[model samples]
Target: MKKLNESLEVERIYTVLEERIEQELEERIELGCWMYCKEFCIMYS
Candidate 1:
């Protein structure tokens, strides 16, 4: 029972970390896209 509880706790922590990583990746991608668009507009205009 104790082992099961420990495993559950670990899984929960891992899930939270994974979510955080995904959010950070999404934010970075969005920032990259915005920067690219800004640069493209400047070059074209």
Candidate 2:
């Protein structure tokens, strides 16, 4: 029972970490895309 509880806790922690990592990656990609668009606009204009 204790082992099961410990594994559940570990799984929750990993799940949270994975979610945070994915969020960060998404934000980074969005930022990169915005920057690229801005640069393109400036270059064309």
User: Candidate 1, which segments miss by more than 4 Å at Cα?
Assistant: none
Best candidate (score: TM-score): 1
Residue 5 Cα positional deviation in candidate 1, in Å, after optimal superposition: 0.6
Local accuracy of candidate 2 as per-residue lDDT tens digits, 1-45: 999999999999999999999999999999999999999999999
Where is model 2 more than 4 Å wrong at Cα?
none
Q: Which ten residues in a row have the lowest lDDT in candidate 1?
A: 32-41
Q: Residue pairs in steric clash, candidate 1?
A: none
For 1-45, candidate 1 gives per-residue lDDT tens digits of 999999999999999999999999999999999999999999999
Q: Go through the candidates in order and give each one's C-alpha lDDT.
A: 1.00, 1.00
TM-score to true structure, per model: 0.93, 0.90
Q: After superposition, how far is residue 40 of candidate 2 from its true place, in Å?
A: 1.5
C-alpha lDDT (0 to 100) for residue 5 of candidate 1: 100
